[model samples]
Target: MASIDMDAFAADWIAAWNSHDLNRIIAHYGSDIVFLSPIAEKLMGNGKVAGLDRLRRYWTAGLASQTDLKFELLHVLRGHECLTILYRNHKQQIVAETLEFDGDGKIQRAFACYQLEQG
Candidate 1:
């Protein structure tokens, strides 16, 4: 999509998270980003984390206690103007993040879904 290399994008995304650098992680996003995540719902009182400022805050808080946070990429699914990264977190939770890119190739929107815990 938009001539963006999905493999490189996914690798950089995973690396950004693993680096635990807020600015590095946010660099992939556009200023008008809208991100949806279960973690966002828990942190921001809603599933929508609209805009860059709010997103930065939410992610910062989410990572506060996750010093060992890391992501292991499992799959990168490409689509029109979008891509989904399936990975396992340091906690061993399976997560899927679908990201839609803007004309500039910066992520304009994103959605994060987690696999339900097995009993």
Candidate 2:
């Protein structure tokens, strides 16, 4: 695993994501990396992604589809070689997620719990 600098890695991840740069985002992950999205039942492999082709579909269909897809970093906790970030999605609705990053600074697991807020 690449000994990635935590703070820099987190910043880059958020920047790439917010920019909607699929290529840059995918570059941060390993070829064998796994993703556990809230919408998925089981862990999904990079191969299962069908490559970036599938990512574009979700990026446009799921994320871009939202009216105001904004995210704010609530907190970040670091361990020996792991990092967890609490973030809130501010759009038409408010959603929160805590992402766990592996030693390589790639997201290994993500837990997303949602709630509706009256604003």
Give the Cα lDDT of each candidate.
Answer: 0.94, 0.55
Q: What TM-score should be assigned to candidate 2?
A: 0.61
Which window of 10 residues has the lowest lDDT sum in candidate 1?
Answer: 36-45
Model 1 local distance difference test score: 0.94
Give the per-residue lDDT of model 2 (tens digit) for 24-93: 7677654444444544333333323333455445555655455555666666667654565556665533
TM-scores for every candidate against the unseen true structure: 0.96, 0.61
Among all candidates shown, the one with the greatest lDDT: 1
lDDT tens digits, residue span 5-95, model 1: 8999999999999999999999999999999988878767899989999999988988897889999999999889999999999989999
Clashing pairs in 1: none
